[model samples]
Target: MKDNPLIKTLFAGSQPPHLIDPLALFLLVLIPIGALPLSPSEEIHLFLARTSLLIYLGLRSIQGLIWTGRRNRSDGWVTSISWSSSLFLGIGWGFLSLSWSLSPFTSRSVFLDFFLYISVYGLMTQASLPGKTVKTLYQFLVMMALLVSLDGLSQKFYRYDAYLPYLTEHPEKFDPHTLEIMKNWITTFRRISAHFLLPSHLAGYLILIIPLNVALIQLTPTLWKRVSWLLVLGVNLLVLFFTESYGAWLSLLVVFAFVLLYPLVPRLRRLGRATLQEDSPGQTPGRLLKTIPGIILLSAGTFIVLTLIGYSRGTYLWDLNAPDHPGYLRFLNWKSAFLILRDYPWTGTGLGTFKIAYPPYMLPNSTEANFAHNSYLQIGSELGLPGLLMVCLAAITWFLKGLTTLSTLSDPEDRIIYRSLFAAGLGFCLHNFVDYDVYIPALGLTGFMLLGLGGSGNAEEGEPGRREEPSPLRPSPASPFFNIAWPACLLGLSLWLFILNGKLYLVNIHINQVKKEMEQGEFEKAYQIAQKALFYDPGNPSLQEISGVLLLQLKQPERAARAFQKAIELDPKVPRFHAYLGETYLLRGDLAGAYVETKKAVELFPLRTSYQKRLEEISSLLEKYAVKNRKP
Candidate 1:
């Protein structure tokens, strides 16, 4: 080998390719960081987060378009189809976006939020996933989880009568009724929220991050790096526990089972078989990883041990029993949700409009409720079965595509990559089942990221599959059809946002009407106002709860109970719902039912002296009722 240093240097491949695209890297860091934890209650916080995501997505797409470089072979049909589908979906959701908006102001806010999700999807697709992007996202999720967990802990221990210290300090912004409902939370032990999103949402956020962390760990090289991932996971898991969000906890377990465990079935079959190894020069047979007969047993054993430790230590995993317990009000929420879903099986009241809409349909004699407590029912009652179906289809489609991509890949690394994506997707999907994390953009974005990972196609390693060769460099202006189509989609989306804004605004006005009427002791007028609000945004659970309260005030016990139940259904994790429903039962002279519900309210929120007092009063009433019944 003649040493011709200059010639050799000239021929040496242009400094090992920068695996990460700079634009993509910039975007990965900026978007999530821009959304960094803010006061959950602050509308500004949400607005900022939404803007950051949109900006990041725009930047990412431009980068992707530039990096991919316009090629002659670019499948115009495929690209058009994909973009068109996205546009249509966005338009549909945009229309939906207006359904539950509170006011012109709230409607505008909500429209922006809805549009943001569309932009996020477009941006995600545009910015093809790179290792650095994955790493950045992973780190963000981990940090967020940690912050939320820590905040949750602080909230619980510090007992904030005013505000969560790290978040916003605006009590004036909150609806007084909303404030009253959440007042009992001062007794909890963590800072899962600063009031913008609830503690349950904070917990759900952590659960969503865990899968991303797992994915990041799979990408790391060193054992220490892997262990660091474990640390992040552990911290998030611990914090999630403190949040007392059993729904999130259950969702996490479901994601683990669906993504990580289900894939293992095929792996177990290939367990003892030899496979090509990356380490061996020229692809040699690697040691066959064993598939133990007791793998299931081992998993079960590990789960058992963890469960024992968690239960003994009073971890969130065991907290689900709270809902199952006689004192926990989860059942009441479930009951209420079902009632709403059954009555409004189609064209739901409206998206995000459940609180106000569900009141008239609630169980009688109940206090006002603010949510459906259940994601499934809430969606069903708001957008109707079709809306629920649309969301479900979107979710399932994302998962199936991701799983398919992962299944066909042979490389262990690739498999892990896809698996991690699947796991992350599973986490969000599961989390949605119990807690409606979808309402919060930050959490929803995280979910969509996992979906994006699933939808994305990865480049093959080793004998690379015939790469989708880059298209020929050309300045292909938008086709006339495309120009028209793009504008049309934008116009449609705008129109929908406008309608949603109007609907939401009207609903808010109607809600305010009810509030004022209630203050004036005009229960019938309040009830009427609530009904009008439902006509505008039938899914407003707050309105529904208020309506139910008004009915109770009007001495309509059955109707009031029904309304409270509906509120619980729209949002089950909120403990006050049980108290409201229990009171309704008491007013109806159903002492036994009152005792049961009040007990549940007390259990879910031990800090609520109001709930405790109700429970005690109900218990005494029940005793007297029992004695009287026996004597009769």
Candidate 2:
């Protein structure tokens, strides 16, 4: 406790205050916990992590963000990290676009994820990064990835469901359908989703982790560490192979080629050396291969070899089949995303609103795709052009800065460490061209952390094994008030977000409790718990829909109509909300309203046979009412 940074800084006579390292570890644990009990909706915020972060922010908000304990006026890389401002601005657009979000609740929930990621990046960049600290973080993440990979391998060789026997035996779970869906997703024939929602998400995690592990193998001097990392990488690559993700395979090849080009092409290496850590990942094969013609031939040959390997293994990298092919679905989603951007050019549909806004634009026979499959296009369609531009600029900046950081490292080990981060981040960026890691917290959090570590661990000349002082790239205000203002804003924002996050988490808990009670024939109890849940997250449409069902069961048609009406407002894209509202209208003897509402439900989701039949029933009822009116 005495050795703790926060402990030393506080309650000591002369020492200046410093923030603690707990925040750092929380950010690191994000990769693994991202997959577990958190699941899909619980991502509102990791309750414990967020609470601790809020406390940290509350303490720092008044003092300042960057600590001066190191250099006694030290500036950190938070704002100065090449493209961070643009990244923040892009996320800023995501926050502001909430006003127009197709589903305000979804936008509100997802924006926190982006906020948490950027905050993690900011917090990481501000802290001092010792080599041991870097190595430990790398090791922990590698082990976690290794476990996930091994689990995936086990699934491939042994069973279909990821942990069906372990997870499926619970009869008390509110929604058994969710478990069935999870089983279906994890059981992608001979492929491993690795407990991720989809195989592609596991592929996303793999591509990012493998390069970093390769970097580790190069950096570690000890044979044991090298062998350990190599084993991890080998397993990771094998899992990647099992995933059979065309984007992961092709993107990795592109990155490997880029790494190769760094050594082969002197002009290119020298060109980016001005402000980045410019270095190659692996050793050159031979001097003969460095010449222009030789390099071109080697590059082409390598590219062809990798491409052919994937093609021969049934990669389907460019399947032109218009239907039933993954690539074609991706193409259709991209096309649909463009149409979304065409209409909502200013702000698009809003952050996390893509799924809500996308259905109306889904192409015929496309099976109702959610994500755009391209992170950039989705960002454009969801957050608008400025948001897209900012994110792109930030990415380009991180890559360039990574190059600069690489060039400055005198030690081969240090250079390799930075290179691995650079390669992993670049690979993820390129991978996003055909997939959406943006929605996956595990991938996005890891990506941002890697991006922050881009220029970390730099040492000043002649100071071996010491952390470098951050170069001040912008003006720092010495005023106490200015410092207090920013931190206060962070504190205030965090406080509000923390409250909302708590609400969301509690709502998830209570709603599940409600469903369990309902399953056990406790309608009154379920209704009571549902109201409690809605009090926390009134914007949740599913909760509202459930409440309507409960109200109808309780024989309160007016209240049921109002509940379904609220659900429709919260999520107009859902067919059932409109259908339920139509049911309430019919109970009230409003035949015309019932017909119109049911018709809209069928129109919104023509694929739902149940909705179509309901619409037909409403139409027949309306016709009978019309015939009776004519007779009167």
Candidate 3:
């Protein structure tokens, strides 16, 4: 192996084992902090992280080919494969939908991002690392929790966000409308977002780490370490409570109940058996009867505490129409998602098409919602019911496998670690019921890493005497071409993706620049910048729409019509494109054309008062023209 040319180039003298653990740890640390830059969107961090991980995997693939001559296996692969295959099929179907996708560019980008996530999941499972690496990662997470808690607590107490000043200084790098939206949001909510876009995002991140902190406290032998972990846990809980994320609060309660009750199950079972076997006829009733008063007191106490908490927190969970209520907004978003699923039940409108597809389905007076706010509903709306089913199956399989592995581990420390990872996974699932935490790259990566660790550790606890067979993933000697070609293709694809995302990043910068130019009343300069952006992302309907609007402002209605028509041709689902085109037709004195386009716009978005008003005005004009023509 040392003498092999491939090994020498990729792995030999490279400290391969040391590299794997550090790279994994670096990713766990980098994702949250790397997300601090507010340029473009939080998704930019995901793009950067995914690109780095993909490149790392590409290099590891070359090393694996030369040294191991086989694909690596994890303990859960047998069970995982079924669910993984289904997920791949769903993503594959998303790619296939590009043919009919309303926004093909969005569909392509989303498909690529998801495909990379799947690749990362596989790589994490295969990458070998020491058990101590997991411990190190947990410690790093604890530090992060403390740091984020400090930031959040400061914002809550001081009434100022530290990151807000930095964002304000870099106005040109982000969307002003988005910044304005956040400014308005913070004024009313008073919640802390920390380094993320929303307070709920911070809460979501904490929920993932909180369980691990609990596990660390249980596993550590020293009182000092336990107290330190307890402090970190308390900080996270305080931040979570102040953030007022009902979903996260509910999830924490459930996870805590599970963690506390899990240890008592065996004892409870023993007590039940002992009572059954007692010779005295009254023993079973006596044992049960003695706990009745305590049970009643406990239930009453719990209800009183809950009432006090709800009142102090001002959380009227039962109120559906309360202003600024998350629960009410979630209901509207979920209803919209259901409507989208009803229309596109199987294949969906297309991946990343939610923003375009959802507007028409929104409830009356609903504010614009980019996400469904429920991960399951979002997945169903974007990928359809089949995709939803596949994702659910994959999550359930991962959880069951982790639990099974935790049961088999005899070491108390190892059991605690696995149990905590399992609980973290469950928390992610539950939080997503009212939020889209899984869609956040940092949280999603953390989750996948924990799952990978759980599955890998499970594989190590084996029978003492049995010899493990070589993984079937090994390439046969007859398929030497495949061994070479597979890795080569992955490397090439990763490079291509890197370049593609870089272009998109530049395109976003240019679009933001154009917006600044427009605000300064430089229509010609704005139009020119938009033209350049369109050249880079030719299929972006939003860019096309922007170009149309700028051309209209420049009084070039003919060119504006061409741009709007092009936008509609690219993504016919958007009502705004039709309305813009109708205005251009009206400018050209084409009453029939204006009437037709505006009517289409109204049909697409019936709740848009502007579109309906335009239609009415056009109808009155047509009616007046009809009377004059009849007299002639």
Candidate 4:
């Protein structure tokens, strides 16, 4: 075995192989840093985190196309191809969804966010997972977890958080609604968000990172490293408890149980025994390095742990569908999402348009929400069932392929690390049942990175670091069809970013300006800004709605009516747009038009007291008109 270079470096305590890759180390570091501010789900625009990810992705794309040799063999095609293809279908479908999106402005922005992050997922799978890179990456996860936990503690005790302090200093940088949310988080809410925007989001991040700490504590090569990981894991758990996120608490218990106990199954035992036969000379016996590293009474152990924590401070167990229950609102959101799916089952309300489209379908007594609180339902409502199917398929492929890779690994340490990453990802997936983390760049990207690392596209002999003979010093041998196809994919992706995404960003800037002007009571200025925005994105329902509002404010009733009608054409599901159009009709003295449009608004959102009152007023006016006509 000409002793593996990585093995040599591990024992020798020499410099790790920098030649293998220094870029992935930078990427690994960037991810934890980026997750902080990018934690919230975007509404009509994107977070600045998108820029950093684009740069990271652009570097990786350059490396793939120019520096690294393209994969020529079918070594890990089952994992790589299947995962990428399914995700591609999901992304492609999301792109197509813009045509039917209820709010194309938001949809396009969200689609770009997903496209970039998922692209990170695909590229990361191909990243070479050598020993030093893997170890360093795990360290980064632990170190950042501890720091974020401390940040949460600060919010609890000192009433200050690292991620939100700057917002107070410069309120103008953020929108008024955003500032209100931040203020509410600090003053109105007791639970800590830390680097995230909500306690649930913080809990979601912990669920994604803590399992790796479990793996690290057991499977780390050194005693000091193991102790540190254990400490970090405890800190993260403490923060998770403080978050009072019941869903994450439950998800952690179940996923940890599965990871720790499931390996004791007879099949896994057989696999462990099989790996024992191939232990390396420097390594301990496989029996000494049991698959779970000795946490076998998982289900009972978790229960005792939960009891000791008092089931996590203020967190109650799963609730009945009561109005006051914490989860009741989520249940309402889910039911409404189901209705949205029923209405737009094929193309969906459009990718990332759930918050825009979901209002009309919300169950009675339900308030407006940004998410379905269920990733699967959100995906279904936003991207349609087929899109959901593709996402599910990608997850299935990652898990199964990762397990297959795990079973084949000859090295005990490699197996442990893989098992740990798998659990981290699995826990987050389970958490999504109650809290939708995948839409948030931080939580979603972290989970995907772990999943990607678990199934390396280059791993062949169950070894992430296993070396293969180098390809000849030339471009990868590909069929004529593939040679052109690969380049075409690149070209299309570039154009999609440059043309469509560029225009989206432009429109977003204008919309932001419009909002600022409107908030300042500068309706004329806002209307002018909106008009300019429409020149760029005439199809965006949001811009049209704002324009209608501005027109109404300017006392231009007929023009406002036209703008509202256009908004209805763009997104008929939004009841307020219809109501505004009805108001325009009322201003114009078209009693018939006012009655018809107001009736439609009331029909769409019967729970709206304002809409109902408006409808009543319209009916009264119509009656008056009829009586006057009869007298004449």
Query: Largest TM-score belongs to which candidate?
Result: 2
Compute each candidate's TM-score over C-alphas.
0.60, 0.83, 0.80, 0.79
Across 1-632, the per-residue lDDT of candidate 2 in tens digits comes to 01223323422323333332544455545633553322333344456655555555555543444444332332232223223378777877888888888888889878877887777666555444445666777787787788888878877877664356644544334245445655654543455676676678888888888877877787688999789888889899878877767777778877877776665655665555553433454534454346456558656864664466455444444555535566777888999899989998887888987776775687876656668889999989998888888888877776766665655566665666667777887888898999988677778777766666563434233111233432334335454444444454666877888887788778878877886787787988999999988887777898999999999988899999999999988788777788899999999889888888988887876766788888888888777878888954
The local distance difference test score of each candidate is 0.56, 0.69, 0.68, 0.68
Better of 1 and 3 by lDDT: 3
Best by lDDT: 2
- Candidate 1 per-residue C-alpha lDDT over 1-632 given as tens digits, one digit per residue, 9 for 90 to 100: 11111112211232211122335435543554445455543434544555455444343333333323433222222243243363435336536556443222333454465565555544344333444445666676577666666665566566475454322333434555555545544433333453345667676667667777777777788999889888877777766655555566566656665553444455532332323233444222222223233445446754664465455435534465553331145445556666666766666555565654544444543345556666666666666677677667766655555544554567665566666666766777766666676667676665665555455553332111111223335433555455334434444544555465456556756665666676677888778878988888765566667877788788888989999888777655446677788889888878878888878766655545677777777778777767887953
Q: How accurate is candidate 1 locally (lDDT)?
A: 0.56
For residue 328, give model 3's deviation from the true position in Å. 4.7
Q: Supply candidate 4's per-residue lDDT for 300.
A: 65
Can you tell me which runs of candidate 4 are displaced by over 4 Å?
A: 1-20, 28-32, 38-48, 52-84, 100-103, 160-189, 219-229, 267-315, 318-322, 326-328, 342-346, 457-460, 465-470, 473-478, 498-510
lDDT of 4 by residue, 1-632 (tens): 12233212211222211112445445554753565652332422243445555554444333333322233322121123332378877888888998877777678777776776676666555555566566677777778778889988887888555445756654655556557766765654456777576788889988888876776787676889778777788889888877767688789877766665554454654433334343365443443466444555555665665554444343334335345455777788899889988888888888887877765676876765778999989999988889889989987777666656666676777777777777887887788889888888778777777766665523357765334434334343444445434534554564566455557667877877887787688999888888898898778887888888888888898888888999898778778888888888889999998889988888877777888888888899899889989954
Instruction: Go through the candidates in order and give the clash count of each.
Output: 71, 11, 0, 0
Stretches of model 3 off by over 4 angstroms after superposition = 1-20, 24-33, 36-47, 64-84, 127-131, 159-185, 263-315, 320-325, 364-367, 459-489, 621-632
Which candidate model has the greater lDDT, 1 or 2?
A: 2
Model 2 misplaced regions, further than 4 Å: 1-45, 65-84, 158-188, 270-315, 455-481, 571-575, 587-589, 602-613
